[model samples]
Target: MRPTLFLICPVLLFLGLSYLLPFLGIVQLSFTDPQPGLAQYRHVLSDPLTLAVIWRTLRLCIIVTVVSVGCAYIITLLWVRGTPVIRLLTELCIMIPFWISVLSRAFGWLSLLSNRGLINTWLKDAGLIDASIQMTRNEFAVVVGMAHYLIPFAVFPLATAMRNVDERVLTAADGMGASRLRIFWQIFLPMTGNGIIGATLLVFVFSIGFYVTPALLGGGQSVLLAELIYLWIFQMPQWGMAAALSVVMMIAVGGILVALMRRNAETAK
Candidate 1:
């Protein structure tokens, strides 16, 4: 084998053994019943609750990706357009968020958004809120937590893409009397938009699979599909049911990922 192919094959083999084999096992389990049939899949698909949970999961994933990418876009722009000191500070802040455990961050958020927590307490003292705002354990809190967790992923792609953009081109457009928004929409955004989409898809995939942030922030009520799957697999040990849900979610993610990759390819040209 060529040296480079030899180097890559072992990594590929490892991934196939670890991720692929487990996934295939899940798929096989999804096809089984208490006696071995497609009952598990039919039951999973026929249920409205499963559909709702799946829809809610997708909705949260989309919202989280949008929020994360929006933040990333602003941060990237500031990093690209601002002073060296400002750029350094923003980059440092983005990295700092990643240094802490996500669970720790989620816990901190609970305090900030809780009624007795900082925001509500401050608001109460100011007479702004009649009661403590209960943001913890709701859909709002889940989206917020997921967005916060995914922000670094979004920023990494957008920042790298933005950095690679030739400023001289934008400067030239500006010199030619293009407006700021036009430069962004027609030039800057479009240029980096592929990377943004890739980041969004990546974040969305991760967010849909997320359990900890949602469990911590969503308070066990607004249970995402990931939580549902986790319950079935680990807590309940209903391997067939869990496998059914996992197969569906993984298929959905795979389709979205294919679309994302194709879009990225077109954007590359």
Candidate 2:
């Protein structure tokens, strides 16, 4: 036990320095800036634009999480059902995007969704539409980019959970004449709820902190919390306000994690 604890010490220290230090610094700044009061936080709460940004962030993250999780679930299920070669191909496809830089992916989406993009160009050549349809710089584009980024995150957790489910149980259900839908609904979903929840949280949390995709694809219309935070620091030079908003975002994510943990604990009990 002592050896194990000693071995873990380095990891713990790394986490403290890397994560805890920055978090504490943000907390300190949020309070200390502008003479050490809750004024920054008050401003964050009172400002209508800030509130709208928060709402938009929540809405976008929720949409991204749902779509990513649903798509990942389907992919994972298909992976389970497929032959070894197919599974290997599918996993390769999934992992390939992750190896590529996120900025590259976002830029790729930009090219695809822009008015003079490949799709619009091809459509115009084919005479599908007289005018280029607006695709980029909108909520739809933001969600698509975010969901594409998050789907891999959702896939791994869900696949792990699904893989852990007993093949014998599925066979038994089939032998007992259970329909495919019934088997999935009754056995698979209940057993995999933890994975689904984990994927949801992972995707949602990451989506909330998205900066590049929304900035590039969202334009003026679909501003999110992360863009607002960036604006406060670099553009507006509102350090106090930025720190306060960061604290709020941290608390919101932390609260969600805590709630999920507590619910899981209760369920375990």
Candidate 3:
């Protein structure tokens, strides 16, 4: 035990210096910079624009979480039940995005969704429409890019839960003449509920911090909390406000995690 403590203490000390110290600095900035007090927090909560941005961030978080998790559930089901080749292909599809940088993926979406891009060009040549549809630089485009980026995050947790399910129970249900839909609805879905919750939490938390995709695709029209924070720090040069927003976001995320943990504990009981 003494040796284990010695080993763990170094790692903990390293984290304290590298991560915790910096975080504490940010928290300090929120209160100390530009004449202290709760003024920064007050402004963040009271300002209409900040409130709107917060709401937009939350709304987009929910949209992206639902879209990513729903699609990931389908992919996870295939991965769990499919043949070796199909599983291999599914894995390749899921992992390919991880290899690409976030900036590249966002730009790729821009090229595909832009007016003169492939989809519009094809549509134009095919005489599908007279004018290009406004696809890029919108909420829809942001959601698409975010969901594409986050699907893999949703997939792994769901696959883990699905793989843990008892196969014999499914076989017994099938042998008992249960319809596919009924068995899935009654057994598989309930069994994977924990995974769904986990994926939702993971994706939603990630979605809140998204910057590049929303910045590029939103075109300033659909500004999220992260973008707003950036504006406060660099563009507006309001470091105090930015720090306050960061602290608020951290507290909100922490609160959500605590609430979910309590609920999960209650459910287990």
RMSD to true structure for each model, in Å: 1.5, 1.3, 1.4
Q: Write the per-residue lDDT of candidate 3 for residues 182-220, one digit (tens) a residue.
A: 999999998898888889889999999999999998888
In model 2, which regions exceed 4 Å deviation?
A: none
In order of appearance, the predictions have TM-scores of 0.95, 0.96, 0.96
Please write out the lDDT profile of model 1 over residues 152-209, one tens digit for every residue. 8887788778888888999999999999999989999888876788788878888988
Q: Which ten residues in a row have the lowest lDDT in candidate 3?
A: 260-269
lDDT of 2: 0.90
**lDDT by residue (tens digit), candidate 2, 30-117:** 9988768999999999999999999889888888989999999988877877889989888887889889888898899989989999
lDDT of each: 0.86, 0.90, 0.93
Query: Can you give the lDDT of residue 220 in candidate 3?
Result: 89
Task: Assess the local accuracy of residue 257 in candidate 2 as a C-alpha lDDT between 0 and 100.
Answer: 82
Name the weakest run of 10 consecutive residues (lDDT summed) in model 2.
Answer: 260-269
- Among these predictions, the greatest lDDT belongs to 3
State candidate 1's TM-score: 0.95
Considering lDDT, where higher is better, how would the candidates rank from best to worst?
3, 2, 1
